[model samples]
Target: MDTFWKDLEAAAEARDADALTELMRAAAHDGGNGEPLGIRYDAARSARNNVDKYAEN
Candidate 1:
């Protein structure tokens, strides 16, 4: 949704890694495509890793 994007943008601008990860998790869970548990787990893990990697920049 528009709100999600706006919030994500705001989080990114603020360099809030935790908020970014949480938003990614929310999007993955609410996508409504019946994603498999494994896929969701992978996504969350990837999100965390990305947040960590970027936070170092």
Candidate 2:
């Protein structure tokens, strides 16, 4: 398995929404997107629903 997290983190820190979206989608297709991208996804979803979590930001 190849790791592309460096690319993802750099993209995230830059706040590159397009890159972030693409990275998340790619990870999803690669079968592990949920854990990584879902951290933020679930966070956003939780915020919208008033659910709280201790998930990393």
Global lDDT of each candidate: 0.62, 0.50
**Candidate that scores best on lDDT:** 1
Estimate TM-scores for all models: 0.54, 0.49
Best by TM-score: 1
TM-score of candidate 2 on Cα atoms, chains taken together: 0.49
RMSD (Cα, Å) for all candidates, in order, is 4.4, 8.0
Q: Model 1, 1-57: lDDT tens per residue?
A: 336556666766676778877876776667534555445445455556776888689
Residue 5 displacement (Å), model 2: 0.6
RMSD of 1: 4.4
Q: Compose the digit string of candidate 2's lDDT tens values, residues 1-57.
A: 545467656665565556656655665456444466455444333333332222224
Q: After superposition, how far is residue 17 of candidate 1 from its true place, in Å?
A: 0.3
